[model samples]
Target: MDNFYLLLYLSVAMFIGSFVAGLVPLAFNMSEGRTRLLSTFGAGLLVGTALSVIVPEGVEALYIVHTEKYLPGAVQNKDRNQIISNSLIQPVASNLAAKINYPTYFGNSVVGKGVVEQMQQSPVMDKKETDEYRHSEASVNFNAINQSIGYSLVFGFLFMFLIDQISKYLSSKDGDRTHLKLTATVGLVVHAAADGVAFGSASATNRAGVQFIVFLAIMLHKAPAAFGLVSFLLVEGIERFRIRRHLIIFSVAAPVAAMVTYYLIVVVENDKSSTDSATGTLMLFSAGTFLYVATVHILPELLGSNVKDYQLVNSATEGSSRGYSESRASLKLIELISVIVGAISPIF
Candidate 1:
C-alpha cells in the first residue's frame, strides 16, 4: 500500500479499536460481583504486564546503558585507524547469575555471566547496517521507548491516585469512608493508554504488526473494564447520567493519549541522542503512577477487613457463605484470580 493510504487506514483502525475495547463496556449492565471478578482479572493483567513486559524490558534496557557507556570504549582496538568500532552486547541476567555462581558450571560468575552473548560474529547484512547512523537511530528510538513508558506509567498512576485522593476526601468529610468510590473515572481506558505507548514505539521500530496486536488486545479488554466502572459507580450510588458521563470521559482519554504519544514518537525519532532526558524523567513518573494504582485504586478495595469478616460469616458461620458484605469479598477473590490469570499467563 502507498504510505498515505496506509497511514490513514492505521489511524482509523486505532481509533476504532480504542472505542470498541474501551467504550462499549460502559453501556453494559452487570452485577457488582461479576464486575469485581473481571476487575481483579484486569488488575492481574496490569501487574503481570508491568512486571513481565515493562520491568524486565526496563532492566534489560540497562544492557543498553552498559553498551553505550562501557562497550563503546571496549570496542576500541589499536588495529584500524577508524574512530568507530562495533561489538554485539547482550543482556546478562544478574538475578540469574546470583543463583548459578559456581566456578565449575558458570566460571566465576560472581559479577554475572552473559545469558545471550551473541559472541558469534555479526551477520553479513548487519555489517553495513551497523554503521554510525543506524546505531545512532536505534539508540535514539530505544531512549524514546524507555522515556515514553516511564512517563506514561508515572502520569497514569499519579493521575489515577490524585482522583482517588479526591474521592477519599469527599467520602471522609461526608462521614462515608466506606463509600469512597472511584468508579474507573480517572483513566478507565487502560488498554488505550497501554496501546498508545506501544503504538508509538511500534511506529519507531517499524513494527506495524505489533501495533495491530496491541489494538486487538485493547479492544478485547476495554469493554470489561468499562463495565467494571459502571458496576463500581452503582456501588458508589452515582446517578445513571453521571455514570455515562464518567464512561465517556474515561473512554476518550486513552485515544488522546495515544495520539499525543504518536507525535512524541515522531519528534523523538528526529534526534535519538536527546532521549535520555525525557526517558529518565518519564520513567520515574511511571514508577509513581504504578505505586499509586496499587496502593490507592486496586489495593484499598482488596484489603478491606470487613470483606473478609463477611465472607467468613457466610461460609463458616452459616450454611450459605454469601451476604451483602460478603459480596465485596467474593468479588475480590474473583478479581484476584482473574488478575493472576491475565498477568501470569503472558509469562508462559
Candidate 2:
C-alpha cells in the first residue's frame, strides 16, 4: 500500500509540475483581463504548496541536525555520556552541554548539579565556576558541513535560474507559441528528475514516509495541470490528436520517476551509514527547486500582463470568444475538472 500510494503521489506531482495555463477555456477564451488573474491563482497554488508542505519539513530537519553540530548540545535526558572513563573529559563535556543550550535534551536540569559534576570530573573543578561557565565551553565544529550547505544554496539558485530563462526562451518561439507547451514539457521532465532525487534520497535516509507525502502532494496537483496545458496547446495550434498524446505522457511522469526512485530508495533504506539527517540536505535541494520554479518561472508568468491576449484575440474574432464559445464551454469545464481532479486526487 505504501508503494502504491507512493507511485500514485509521484505520478500526480509530475503531472502538476507541468501545468498548462492556456488550457482553462474560460481564461483562454475570456476577456484577457480574466486570464491574467487565473494564471496568478495557479501560481499561487504552486507557491502555497511549496511553503505549506516542503519548507517546514526542510526547516525542521535543518534545525535538528544543524543544532547538533552548531550548538554544544547533548541528547537531553537519559545518560547521553557513555560510560567510558577515558580521562572523563568527554562525559564531562557532554554533561556541561546538557546544562547549557539544551538542558532538557541532555537531562541535566539542576544548574549547580551540572556544574559540580563537570568540575569534579574536570580535575580542575574550581570554586570560580558559575552558571556562566558553560558559556565559554566549546564543542566540535561542523564548519565544513555548514560550508557545503552554503555551496548547495548557490548551486540550486543558479541551476533553477538557468532553467527558467531557457524555458522562457522556448516558450516564446513564434512558430510555437506552444513555447510554454514545449518548455513545460522540459519542465515536467526536470520536475520528474527532481522528484526522483527527492524520493531516492529519502529511501536512503530511511524516512520513506516523507517521500510518500511529497509524491501524494505532487499527484494532487497535476491532473488539472495536464488538462490546462492541453487547452494552452490548442492555442499553440496543437491538434486534438497531439493533445491527447501529451496528456498521456504527462500523466505517466510520476510513475516513471517513482520507479527510478524505488531502486535507490531500497538501496539506501538498507545502508547503515545513511541517516535521517541526510533528509535535511535533500529537503533543502528540493526547496531550492520549488522556490526557483514558483518565483522565477511560474509567478512571473502568472503575474505578467497577458490581458493583451484577450484584446487582440477579441479583436481578431470580432467579439467571438476564442475558446469559451457556447459550443466549447462544456468541454473546457471538463478540462478544468480534470485539472481539479489531478490536483486533489492523490489524497484518496
Alpha-carbon local distance difference test for all models: 0.46, 0.47
Which digits, one per residue and each the tens of the lDDT, describe model 1 over residues 1-348? Answer: 242234345656655554454344355544545544554555555555455544444434444443454333222333222223223221133333345545656676643334312222222224454465447755675686666656666685666555545543444455542344431354344434644454344333333543454344344345555555555566567777776676666566555665566567445446543343333333334334444543444434544434323221111111121224543433345565676686675475
Task: Give per-residue lDDT, candidate 2, residue 215.
Answer: 54
Residue range 1-348, candidate 2, lDDT tens digits: 465455555555555554332234423444443443343344444454445555556555555655543333332242324322323565566565556654444455576556655644543323344223334432223544565455654565566666655654555545554455666656555654664555454433334556655554444334344444555556677777777666566555555655565554454455422343555566556656655654554333333324343221111112111222223212134334433443343233
Model 1, poorest ten-residue lDDT window?
310-319
In model 1, the runs with Cα more than 4 Å from the true position are 1-28, 74-82, 85-160, 170-222, 228-246, 276-296, 299-336
Query: What number of clashing residue pairs does each candidate have, in the order they appear?
Result: 16, 22
In model 2, the worst 10-residue window by lDDT is: 312-321
TM-score of 1: 0.51
Error of 1 at 302 (Å): 4.3
